[model samples]
Target: MRKTLEEKLVPPVPPAVRRAMLDAREALPPGGADVTARLFAAMKENRDAPTLPSSKSFRDAAASESTFRTLLRCLARYAPHICTSNAVTVSEEWYARRPKHVTMGKSTPVQPTIWPAAWRALAPALDAAPIKQSSKRRYRASIDRCAAMVRAGRASSDFGFVAAADLADAFLFNADATARVKPITAAGYLDGLIALGRFGGIDRVHLLPMQLVAEDLREQAAMMPKNKEARIGAFMERGGFGYAADRIAVCLRRAESLPVHSAAGRRALQTAMVCAVFMNKPARKGDMVSWRIGHDIVRQPNGEWSLAWQQGKTGKNTEAGVLWPEVCYILDLWILGGRPDRLVYHRYHELEGLFLLSQSECQAYRNLPSELTLSAIGVPSHDLRTAAADYMRHYDPEHAANVISAHLGHGSQKSGEAYRSECSAAAGQSEWQRSRMIWS
Candidate 1:
């Protein structure tokens, strides 16, 4: 009974509840969001619902916590680490509603999801598509801007009025005049002139706006299976978001040309860069473009998302409901994202054009914290992870380790200890594309 309910819960029982369930768990609609509160109610009543919990679902979530903490998070609409006191009572009630697990006398396989039937029939010969390289700086700036705009009312424009004279009298805007003052230039003037509203505080203008070629949407679009559970790699294998061999090659060049000695050295340097970006934010492996949800890219209204994923490590169903929005969104955008189908697909490699790239003695970030120590210099990826934190704490100082940890997805503030050292963080996965200078 317990396992069956847990397995079937993927599609959700009642879709109304299901949609809300997903909203409560992952994607949240802007405003009118009582999900955190409702989610808490649900967790308090979870044992009464007749289902077994899954550990994988929550354990692997970015910044996942103990089962008790997870339930409290859903109840409180915030993470335990951030919460103050109100959450304690909600969590206590959650454990009180426990269900008996007699049905799990033996371990049965979790049932197959609807996506398998929907996609398994794909022909082995589907036409392969080309992928292009993405602009990490551009991608990062765009995401940061888009999220900020949504919080503000300016991103959406309304045009219901129809007045010919008023419209004709309006100023004519064109490239000639627009070129006189770049958006960046205008933003600088504005910051000096007016008060930017507070959503996340720094009222920086969203640069990745549509229309301008230079201020192009920091786009990285990838289309993959709609199923939430599917890994983004499945979709990226085919390529989307203009991510092509050319672009990847460029990024690789950038990574390789960095002053680092080897791949690990490059990775160290990349880590340092991420440390710089995520100074005040919580940082996680999945938070950077390197760990996007879809391994490749996805086209989102905001911009392009290259990685889509479901963490395989998190289990315990109760913990799955707590998602740290901006943090998860950042993680899902490129780093840890990719369609599972693409990962499993036979043609993914050929279409991805990643085959031309060689596998490192390191499995990219996957083999990070590799069992193979520095034959003599000897420091693990964990050390690198730590070094990143320590450096941020000492050298960067201004940014919050919590913010860095949130972005990095460390289990604890102890993870923030990485800020206390002299560490070099470098980008690893596609370094060759990062620092390269293209002749064309």
Candidate 2:
């Protein structure tokens, strides 16, 4: 009798190992099951023995390096006993031995363009300007981009003199052409020009034109509707803040019940804490990721949790007082129970204070909110601010603007209004009327 297709694909492993792999296939997500099967087949091809091959051998047999990584994660989750080699070590080795193809079929390397003389001259001034390190980097990048645009348009080698006209031309080129830039990006380049003008390097008279253009660009960008109303409606339809809070509580409970060493438990704890923090206080993603224990997050004398940080965008001192008890509880669980287990021993000294340890971990936390909710209320982490703003506006019309200004770390009350949904106005009016009747 001829062998079936499934039998032909099955690797010659022990019955027990084969059973574990079969269970893994059943347990894993659709994509993950495929990856697991590929991993098993690769292992069989690399060695004659029924025993698992070295990580390097498996990597060699993998279709791509990413596939090898997925296999490692699958092994860690479903068949940990069989995975003896350290995943991190194998990853480092794979990275080190990755094919170093200098040219992709006779392609020459593109060298970085040297900074134009005008930008180079202003570099020292930009560095010395009492601005944040991040801002300085952004301004420098904008200058480089603007210079490239100018060089591409003009034939002059002495593209050393940057002026208001040049910047306006660049903006127009980016706004109306094939290589168009976003309005926000154009605003950034204009900011770079304004900075240069303020440094006394360029003519101060040029400042007005750049500022006006930047303002118009910003207004236009803001006026372009993003279908936020539909998203907000969908979010509220799914029980809004109440539903999210309930889900977070469930995640916290699950985390607490699972063993301390469980990676799934750690992730659940992380997701709960992140959602709680964002729910109580909607902060910028950068601020959320960069939160250090003692500095940004602190325990007050009254035993209430407090957050204090300078807003990265507006550079304003922002503070949130006495967070929700649920938020505080989850923070405690993460700090006392979860974070320590997740930290690598050697790197503990360096990363112990950071709330979200690394960029990858931060990304995972950001992604968890949507995944946990089954994509019913999908929104980026930043959109949490809008949600909070809309919720506040609905409940309290008079105080919402002021509260939103402080809650979201906005520079002014006017800035807070940008986050308010159109529907919130009607909701706020009805709530205000109900409040009047109750008080009357």
Candidate 2 ranges with C-alpha deviation above 4 Å: 1-113, 154-178, 226-234, 237-239, 242-273, 298-306, 321-351, 355-377, 412-414, 417-440
Clashing residue pairs in candidate 2, if any? none
Candidate 1, residues 1-440, lDDT tens digits: the string is 33322233343243444444455544433321232333323433443221222222222221222444534333223222211122322333344554444365754555422212211132111112121112222233333333233234323211111211111112122224632433343333222111111122322343212122122111211132223223223323434112322333343355444322123434433333332223223223322223322242232333322233332222111111223343234322212112222222322332332310121111244432222222211332233344445444444444545544544454555644644222213223123344464532
In model 2, the number of clashes is: 0
- Candidate 2's residue-wise lDDT over 1-440, tens digit each? 86432453355434554566565544654344455555566666766333334555565545566776666655556655443222333565568776555576664667675666766777788889888887887787777666776677732222223444465456656555776766766777767756755673666455666677778777766877666667767777878788778778788788766644355666677777777788888787766766666567775444467788887778888888778876776776665443332332322333346564231223233334444333323555566778887777766766677777778888865675554444466567787888999999
Please estimate how well model 1 matches the true structure, expressed as its whole-model Cα lDDT. 0.30
Q: Where does model 1 exceed 4 Å of error? A: 1-380, 395-399, 413-440
Q: Weakest 10 consecutive residues, lDDT, candidate 2?
A: 357-366
